[model samples]
Target chain A: MSAMGDSGYRSLVDPEGGIVDRSIFVDDQIFNDEQEAVFTRAWLFVAHETQIPNPGDFFVSRMGTESVIVSRDRESKIHVFLNSCRHRGMKVCRYDEGNTTSFTCPYHAWQYGSDGRLLGVPQNLTLYPDLDKSQWPLVEVPQMENYKGSIWATWDADAPPFLDYLGDAKLHLDLTLDGRDGSEGGSEIIAGVHKWIIPCNWKFPAENFLGDTYHNISHESVDLIGIGPSAAAGQKGRRDADIAEYQHVWAAFEGGHGVHSALRPAELGYQPTFRDHPAVEEYYRKCFESREKRLGDAARLVPFVGTLFPNTSYHGGQPRALCVWHPHGPTSTEVWRFFLVDADAPDEVKELLRKYYMRYSGPAGMTEQDDMENWNYATAGSMGPVARRHPFNYQQSMHASSWEGPVAGQVSTQISEQNPRRYYEAWAAYMDGQSWDQIYSLGQQARGNGR
Target chain B: MNQLPRTSAFFALQAEVADVLSTEAHLLDDRQYNEWLDFLAEDIVYFVPMQRNVEVGTHAERETTREGKDMHWFEDDKWTLTKRVEQILTGVHWAEEPYSRVTHLTTNTQIVTAEPSVDDATIVEARSRFIVYQNRVEYEEYYFVGKRTDTLRRVDTEIGWELVRRDVTLDQNVLLAKNLTVFL
Candidate 1:
């Protein structure tokens, strides 16, 4: 971790002092630099595989601020390409999502196949002779990887592979993507996408999700109202009491990914989560029993929330979903959330989860609506001259951390700001143009690999 | 097109339905959330679908997300709706603490269908357009314009009608507001 201080990017981010420059949220120059340094080079979440499972299906998504089309070709190969047409600058595909034989540019009718191959040029033989069609395919992302059901892409070809970048973060992310029965990649997104705009910097939501355990106090109204899974059963909090005595871990990886997960002790087994629905409780009880049998000691890890590096975030347990905070400018974010449910889940379970997700997430959500209010006003607060001079205090429980957490990475047992500190440290490295070798702090990797 | 003559009974029903809508909007505008709950049935199903940009041919099938099966801005019931009101009443819900100045405008009112005949209708299918103007704190403002199709039931109460089911179609494909704290 000391190598991060030697990289000459420590001015904006001082981990020792645990204070960060406010310009990263409000400065135009920092925002512009981040487009190339942070978003372009990082493994950005493009789309979920379930969004475009069939051949010829496509879904328009955003990498950073630019639009990209995530398409499954007729041959069933997934590809991500810039939405711009080669001949002219017009967007080749404007409709949000639909299956199509080709993306025909509305401007000049420059047609490109679902595979992003240049298919048609109006009067190619007479208007433009000797024009090589092979040279002009729609510009595709240099690298793309589908980890489990998630699709990630990077513009920089030299960037590390997706799994390598995940490092120790994979175990926590796996908890989010896996099924309740301890199966591999059984989660599938629900039918529609929830999209909204927030007037705030992109990092506000990203850093919030990057294991900000201290922000629970801000949700005082929601916690008082008690809208958890067992809220009707005298459970008065934001989540179920199944993990009351479980060891809560705030884990941060070398590559800037971080998660807040709980390790359930074997002594506290099969706590009922849903008081209103007996079927739901029974379903989960069976899942917990089989999970213990299948994964043995590993099944103890339960997911809460996590953010994967730049802008992708997830809520694994109660309100299961994957979300992306797309950078619109220095002070705006376009958020898209894909709610997830197990593919084999009973219709009743899916229905219950859907209703829970509505009240727990998105703009209408009781819990996250309060969060958006904070983000909106906080971004406005950062733009003032005097307010910008002072940095935010992030020194809570600064030195109280263990090198090898039971989960992975730098582990904090109590409420701590170490995750955000690590997140900003890696963010400064990206801003300073450091390579993968200099970026990843591999001291914790050895412990993560022991499993 | 053939036309049916507008009868005295039809005019009476139309006026009554429009009055119910007008009263509901006023309750919200006055910040009478607790009183507004009386206008909803015990088993009311409130849904606001997320509009999507689809191919021309798929408009009927894919323009809006399915109510019970897909994700949306809102797909909740009376219990959850009551919780929203309760959360706001706590006086600490930052999204609505100061309470944004909101005015809901309902127009283009029409009675599309009537069950048990128009003359003796106890249930009616109504359609209208809404424009909600919200200004928050000091400078934030948002305009939500959309279509609303509601199932209004004629109840034997002082208000005489209650919202049995409400399905709102917010015209924008992507919601332009940060949060949907106000009721639609």
Candidate 2:
């Protein structure tokens, strides 16, 4: 498909360019198009494997607007199926997560096995004698894959292979998903999902995490609360302006996957405060040692926050939160956040990690409070006719740096628009109705030419 | 359903507990955060667990206690609560910049248990339904309902009751508000 086709997706985002029209955030038509084009076709994160470990364990998750049951069958195989019952379309499973051998619809006593096979229907012999039970199973997700421990599913079966879609972004994703020692078990999602609604476009959070360390200024209040490093620098005043200069890296991967990372001093290590306790500190030291051996110097730094293409993002460091910006509409997003900790961490460390996660990233989190205010206002502002006409600027540090590091893809200083530009470039590809192959080739060409 | 029988002493204790709860609610509703801190015991553990929609057969997995569970919306101690108050008083915490106007409605206050008077503190266990109505901007209003189980300790006759512990279990699994800046 041509970029400048009838969809006008080309006009929505400049082809491989930085600027983006504001209408993309507020237009209903564009939102619907994204649901069909980007969300359905792209690999969307469902749940971590640890969430549904045992047979009959299940959790209800969303793929775009459609709800799906992510479960482990009696055979202990993972399955993702639509939550809707084939009998009448009511949600077969209503719970967030639980362990059950079968799901029975509340409306009618229609039962489905853990593997999503229609098992029983109340009064089947009386109500519908000739009903074909095999033909009435819950609709299954076309493609589902587990990378490391995180589970992802896509509605489009023809989408690129999961790891191939991840590409170089997997290196960054591994820092969180896969443990340092390459242990048999990776990370585990905390007990519950910290979910809340934000009155903003989903792209704002996605793009922000992808590469907008520039927004660090907005978190000055968080620093003042003695939570951020700038707070520790006290009397010298914050060296906020030069944060990007301090060993930061940006990686733009194929398929719009990108990450902006800040390499904390190697001596400081992963979670420095944990070092205060002898046992906890020793555990971290061993982990870091293994990580350094595996990933080299890159292991020393943290991927502060980065998007796994479209909507899923992982924010590591003090309070590691795995976030999914579930788009409700063009104007609003439902953010499903899960705190992740190394499955092998000590109980005390896990407790502290959970506390840190809640304190900094949950619905009442201080850092998120600041960001939501900006995004909420930004979304509301775009509703204005005059505001929608103008394009939001993405030209910051546009040509400042090129790919010149050990990282696999396009590399830039942390405070650059290169990641967002690349993100929208991929968005434009999907929106323009291009095939996955075409999108991959376009990204490769762009990266090759250093665009 | 195993509620303590109402007696003369029980009535008096209930009245006192109701008064203390009313004052606490008033302080929170008025945004008297610093003053509200005084009502908490020195080693208070205030927490709000995240409710989940677990299936019917899985009551064991669904039941969460303060010590057993890793996930909670608010797991705060006196120190953390003080810090939260300090953050709010800085006049810069963006979520509470304009300060949410809140009304904490406490009802159905039931005394679950009461221990005999002791030298250090008198222990009292109570439960109440809480509905917090919060208004931020002119157009935005949010309501959160939960049931609270509080362990109040009357430390000596002078200070009366201080909240040693509180467990708030919200009705909604997914919070609709932008932030849970207000105390429930």
Candidate 3:
């Protein structure tokens, strides 16, 4: 099929000679293909063991097209399984979450233990003369792994090992999981999960976190967390006209992942006290002061923002959180946010974390709701024929691309089309059947480095 | 149910409690935030513990009868509540856009107590069933019905009761609609 005619996959480049793909957000067939090819095959995040700490505790979560139960058995070990019953395909556990030793399928009296073991089959001999009770346990997910207390599972039997898939992302994950001190232990999802749905492709939000800094400037006024609208008009009055310096931003990693730290520096009005805060201020200082001795001069200079490949994004610093963008359909996505706080942090610190969580991402949170509304509204506009006919532009700062680093990297100005360009580059590679390793290798090749 | 007060005293206290409750509800529904703030005591405690189904039996049975969970939905003093109101008035508080239209009905008022030590005022405990239906623009309306158990003490003048504490026990675990933008 032609690029435009293709349902699941298409290549879109801007008029100014850049690739731009819109099929990922519009085609239902493509959505179906992804449900099986991407979501089911990958080791998707379910729930942290901390969420269900005690025995018989369970939390219901969506794994792409399927509903799976993540629970703690009597042994206090975490287990993940298809929530459906072995007999009639009825959902065994109905509540969103609860504690129960055995789940009785309401259709019949067949009961299953927390470990996905078939405990009872109503009347084993009477119901079916030769029924084998041992063969009818609840269907468990193919593989379940708990790495650093965050539970993840995969449905595909032939998928690569979890650690190999994680690659360099594991280091970033550890940095996130292990609290700033990395001494008294790590942070926990203290406030529980804040879940809500938005009407947009899952990747749209994922790419936003990946590197789209344009929205920060274009949608500044509408952004609930952004600087006041008057700040936009008074650009000349500002001391540092270079938006980057005013924003306290940083981005770079071994993988395609990047996050802007504009909200974390002192000059940027937003992060004036970022250096004063005890948790990350010292970590930030140590990295900056003794760059060579600590994290390496190059690494020390780059303050972390969010993750890149696979999935998941972390907002470091106080009132920290992890945002997981889960695909719901071609045009709908559900975002589950887990606010983090150091397990040993003071009660007052936890309270501050709670206030921040509610302010930014909670059900009544300011910025999150606005983000959702804009994404949803944008999706609606894309559905229009004429609007979509005009390829969505990413042409801004196209000429600004410059080759840099050890490799000939397509470096754009910090606030340039770098994110969207890199995103499409990765998307084309992924759709064209390149493994994540191959894609990251290509990125490194373009930058003249070999991994 | 058995510990209800004497009919006459109970009726009088019930009448006073209902009047005070209606006035408070009017102030809230009418968006008289400042006026409503005056009705609450300085050290008021508001609680809304999670509700669960329990079977009637002995104390032992009740002990393990699902130690119903606790949710501090609004575990705040006056300051926090004041800030919340102020935020609602701010231009950026989008959750309240088109505002949450509410009709708070407080009925079935029955007094259960009268303190003797307090000279002019009365320490009357009352129960009133309440239902608040909120309508959010372009979205579905939400309904919340629950029992409002309140402890009321006489204000300085002894004319009416001032709510000392309000324990609102909601009947459902899962919220039935989108966001909850209004106070229960």
Candidate 4:
């Protein structure tokens, strides 16, 4: 970790155990290194299997600075290809999402099959008769796999297996994906992928998603504009109530992923009224059971686990999502999210899920907009050279961040900076060029018997 | 193709609509959000209908709902618009801060029809196409294409017709900018 500081990147450290210092969220050189060392090697989420349901269905996604096309082939197999065409470096597919048997690059009419195999190249029959077609196929991602129905691809061959990389975060991922499988298989993604770009470092949203319950009190408490039913109802009177609820997960997983479950304490024992539908009830029951089984008899039950690692973060069975944290430059990041629904579920269930996701996490959602405002103002204000000189502090409750294994106790408390500390800890490892194996070993040591 | 000369009543109605829209755009561009609220009619209805193309067979006989050609984008109302505006004034608005510069050039104003034999009150609709050139501090320019429909009435001696309704139908399905925070 000290070596990372030697690389001209200043490390903010606190001996008391909380976040000592972190400028990665605002630095330019660190952002450039992240594109190479982190994004280029880390497995990035592509799309869900349900998104490209049939042959020829395709959706474009970005992993760090590079763009890739994730599509399903004639065999219904998912393929990840660099969006650049083999002939002239033009984008083979222009549409954000569509169904196409073969993509013909507009630049030179070179066509490629859904499987990423080069199908046709204009004038190749005569001009490059000796050229091998097999060597010119779309550049396939080095590693691609599906965790449940969610798709992920990596550019680095040295990346670990998808499941192994997920580690403890895998349980939460399974809860989000497989938990729905308990009743009628599972759900599917609807027609649209809920996306919007917020003007902040992608890490800002990532950190907020991972842990930042303080914002609901700090920002939303003042501006009571209603974006949804819950928010509207909460703000209907003289003294408006903050429309955010929390249940925070206080743990870290292997692969550098971590979780935080935050929910309003008042909502405890608030059972769903319409559980008569067997399928719906079963799905909800499994969700509850999964949390209980995983958390055991902790005093407070966490409804979801916020997994923050690599480049993506989200919770299992939860309505919120945080992805990309995609960098626009040194100080700005474009954040995109998918508030998905299980396709196999009923329309009413989908509607409920949509409203839930839309209410708190979507672009226009209440909590989400509140977050964007603060992030925008903070990042925008921190841009001035004078402001950059100020070392942003995170030294709060570090020594008190006690844990039994990976799960930190008293994490749901609003003032805990433990999550940010954990985040920077893993970040420090990556900045120091620690191999994945070595990092995992260190993470296990950090978590003790949790692994 | 022969039509009567545009009348004084027509010009008055058109003038009202143009004034309302320009004022609205100014409020948005200048971020003078609080003042923008007074222009909207309390019962005003704002809708950007999602247009979709239905198959010719399903929508035969030259009906409007044909696939690949027809679509709807946003169908909103006064309530929704008010809420949208409120979010901005509250400082929680993320879409428009350091606001995107926008200039609404509304032209080709025409009075399509005027209800005849009506009392002092007259019902007339104005049609105009506008091009909104907008950009943030360091982003690419976004071209917003659409036609604005304003229902206006000439009241007493006001400088412009009093706007009762405004509807904008954008041609593009996907919003090019990061977010749509201003009126076109």
Candidate 5:
């Protein structure tokens, strides 16, 4: 294996650090290299277990560039397999989602069971009497794991265990995925997936969700329109006094994962925060009590948004939205948005949350409309020769961070680029063709150096 | 589910209904959204249900239930529709700042049910197929094809019809457009 040269790769990111070359967004060679070095080896999110609740239930999902079927077998074991035929490499199952006992290839009529075992092939005895049927099965994803109902898989057989891969990010993920006490069923993805295309590199959205509070200014129009209290207040011009009062925290974890969150003050009286609906408010109050008992002081903080390394992201609070930025190529991405709600919540609250989700974060949503336009233009501008030569700055609040909080990872204020700096550092590590062990160690060393 | 025969009276009513639909389409395609809002009844429920593929024995009941068990793309009442129109009309909506050029092609109009002797004598349920072509910026173009079920009520003799309810079901499981800023 040819490792990336220090000069060639290190030049793409600033040698002194906290700056990134624009070429990474539009370079064809770098994009192809990422498919092999990052996507194939990384643990990527596939589907939630609740999405395929029963035996034979399946959902077609994409991991990087390869399409896979996330399904449950007769014995209720979840499996992920490449949705390709063994004979000639055609997609065996074409629908986005469905339940079936077997998948039959359209072109050659080759059949495979829900367990991905080859059940039949056309003219098996006539064409080749000695051909072994046991040797042919749909290519299985090498490793799979379920954590709090969210399913994840990796093509690399040697990838670390999912929990270890999560590291301290597991604490924040549990806040959204694990719900309240004995109601361990947690949150379930609502029935539909909102998918749409964007003419931008996948990293723009992924990095934004990871930590890009600076772009909140782009959402000023949403505030002018008076959509929500948070939108109306505007994140700009907040004094250090306000930051301390709100208890705003931006924490970056190991393995490039991080969260930016702040407590929505009670005096703000945000409607979706349960101030408008008493019943829903009462339910959440108890839920928060249970969470406080479980997570201690950390439960008091409300997570606004966070990213899980390479692609998947989640936004907590009302009308919760989880997203996966599926990379199409160097210049485009296919965004899959899933809305989630607590399974135990009342039907009316669920309906209210669904409507709120459609209005705020769906493809045609008010707030997201602003984000898409910015990303689309930003990605397009990178194609210019002069533009690609310059590097983007990520030096905001670089030296201002402390580990004093009870929360895990390197902590900073809500408005800072330290999180994105950490993200690109990880990206550079992967691009350097470092092994997972090396990458893990790099994170530790960076943590020791502090933000 | 009574299918009305193609009598002269039915033919006249069908043409009038088609004209009403055409006028509404023209208003939307021309971006006369406030005028388009006037064509809707005060109690209108405009909904677009989410589509899904399921097994042979299973039914994707996104439209059948009212308890919000199933997800939908849009479930707007008159007030919500008005709010959406207000949002679009605001000059700051970046997604629509350039303003997409839209063309709505509606065809295959049929009256599914008509009861001429009732109190609301001219009330009818109609269905139509629509294909909306939307172009934004210099390079992006989107084609959205869907079938719409509508409830039309003849409000007065001078004004032909007003849409009281509409349910649009799109064919694509995953919408390929950047944003669904245009109406179906």
Candidate 6:
């Protein structure tokens, strides 16, 4: 609606006043512009390498609205390529996931190698003799990285490297992907993926995951009826009561990433989780003791939830998983959730965790069911012209956040909107076509959006 | 499925199975959640698995996620299922707080197999199709179409049969609906 680029973004998003215009969630033009501005430049999380362990294994994944094939080539090198055939626009491979040496487009007999090389035409010599196979390989992403067994790619060649894009956010994410015993990265996806659709803006879930402690009321229902692992043992809460002993930290990073982690007051002790099964209880107790011993005080920062800038989100503890809010439209999101567990954990530990993961996440999940309902209607409520006139408030504990706080970036002890405010500030920078220098070096004083 | 012997007792057993399904649909649609719980046995296992797209021949083995071994939409037992009902009845489960108007349209009833004989069946394998339509909060609506394979146990109570196990094959790879707050 408004002119885009440099000046237009400031009108919609004002991180200083701690206010954001509602159009960002419902407008079609702005949503369309985001595909090129935000989605293309950001390092998006594709399939984890563990999903396709051997050669020729492929998984269909999404970057934004477009589909991409994440395949392990014949040489076992991972590649993220556009799923479309170079000749026509048909999808090269239709299956969600499988092992294939090469993909054959159903529309035409055009075959491609797992490395995305255009291998054979229907009639290579006769049909088009001048067509060079080297010229028409599937459009590959310009930049790619495998950080902690997870794959991330970006279309922008000028974009910063994946770790630099992650910056301070990597430490928070390692707690999710690393093994419970303080191993660097031993987590792997479970056998299946929970994919579903939700009628809401992508940012609704993204912002929710980025340290929104204010919306705990959204999950009051699941909280009332305990669905935690220890719920069967007369616990009346949505998660383990062990978190109650620690101080909650809402950590924000300059690269638009933020996390809700916890800090123990003093020395850590074994927290009684998985009380229903003694084997599971014992397994976790050993993990906790070893993690405490290995990482020393570093293990005190237990991860709760986090969002990596533009789209990816993760639930580190409880329902351990990663979610990518793939945008379908301004008001529709195709959510893909991948459950994670230690690849070498005991069968009992993996079994109980998988069962608890299903009960806590996805469309049918008890805790996440209410979340979808809230996000769905919230998108609808913001669609009308009458609602767009008034701006949404983000000024919770405006100056209460500290830049020199313990964890990373800006830190807030009690519940605060400091993370979301800074998150939007960085989002607006991207929408304005800011350079990587501006996006990563957003050094501000109390989130006032000052240079 | 082998052709069932069309005896008079078999016909009578068919009627009893159909009534059990039809009655349970009414109890759920009428917002009588507490009463609907009566239809389930104490050890009922309700599972809804996520579907995946694989090669045709592998459909039987790898199409749907495993019941106890993989991630699924639901792998709930009696305790977890009861908690779901309790959440809706809490009047604060915002997903169903105002309560969506849902209808369980079940059809294609077939009695696959029965224990002992159809004449004196204690446990029966029943198959049917379901199209659960839910309309909520003004303009929100979704159609959940699926197949249900249920194991029903004959009881001496007024309800006639209780559902011991229900395996729902939702005809969706990626679930089209947002939240499955309403039962399928």
TM-score of chain A of each: 0.95, 0.90, 0.77, 0.82, 0.91, 0.97
lDDT by residue (B46-114, candidate 3, tens digit) is 555433322234223321112112123344455445545655555555556557788898888877656
Q: Provide the TM-score of chain B versus the true chain B for each model in turn.
A: 0.95, 0.91, 0.81, 0.72, 0.90, 0.96
Q: Give the higher-TM-score candidate: 2 or 3.
A: 2
Please give, for residues A391-416, the per-residue lDDT of candidate 5 as tens digits. Answer: 88877887776766546777886477
Give a tens-digit lDDT track for model 1, residues A1-451: 3222444445888777889988788888778888888888999998889989899999999999899999999999999999999987799988888899899999999999999999899999999899999999999999999988889999989988899989888988888889899999888899888889999999999999877878888888888988888888878777688877889898878878888899988677788898878999899999999889989999999998889998999987888889999999999999999989988989999998988888989999999998999999999999989988999888988877777568667888887887888888889878888788878953344235331
lDDT of 1: 0.87
Tens digit per residue, CA lDDT, model 6, A1-451: 3346546686787776889999999999889988988999998999888899999999999999999999999999999999999989799988898888898888887899999998999978988999989999989999989888889999999988888888888898999999988878999998889899999999999999998888888888888999888898888878778788888988788778989999877765777888888898888889888998899888888889999989999999888899999999999999999999999899889988988888789998888988998999989999999999988999987777776777877888888887787788888788888888888777454356431
lDDT of 2 by residue, A70-168 (tens): 999999999999999897899998888888889999999899999989999988899899999999998998889988778899988898889899988
Superior by lDDT: candidate 2 or candidate 5: 2
Q: Kindly list the per-residue Cα lDDT of model 6 for residues B29-120, writing each as its tens digit.
A: 99888778888999999989888888678687778898778898888888888899999988899889799999999998888888998888
A best-first ranking of the candidates according to their lDDT comes to 6, 1, 2, 5, 4, 3
Which scores better on lDDT, 2 or 4?
2
Q: Candidate 5: where is the Cα deviation over 4 Å?
A: A1-8, A180-185, A227-245, A263-272, A293-296, A448-450, B53-67, B116-122, B156-160
Interface RMSD of 5: 2.3
Task: Please provide TM-scores, in order, for all candidate models, with all chains considered together.
Answer: 0.96, 0.92, 0.73, 0.75, 0.91, 0.97
Write model 2 residue lDDT over B72-104, tens digit each, in one string: 778887856776787788777777787878899
By DockQ, who's the top model here? 1
Each prediction's Cα RMSD? 3.1, 3.4, 6.9, 6.5, 3.8, 1.6
lDDT tens readout by residue for model 4, B57-151: 53332222122222223334455566666655665444554456777777777766556612233666767888888776575367788887877
User: On a 0 to 100 scale, what is the lDDT of residue B57 in model 1?
Assistant: 99
Stretch of 10 with least lDDT, candidate 4 chain B = B63-72
Put down candidate 4 lDDT per residue, A205-314, tens digits, no spaces: 67765656555564442246654433333433111122234444465555556665544354454333223244655555565555455544441333353644666777
lDDT for every model? 0.87, 0.78, 0.59, 0.59, 0.76, 0.88
Q: Which pairs clash inside model 1?
A: none
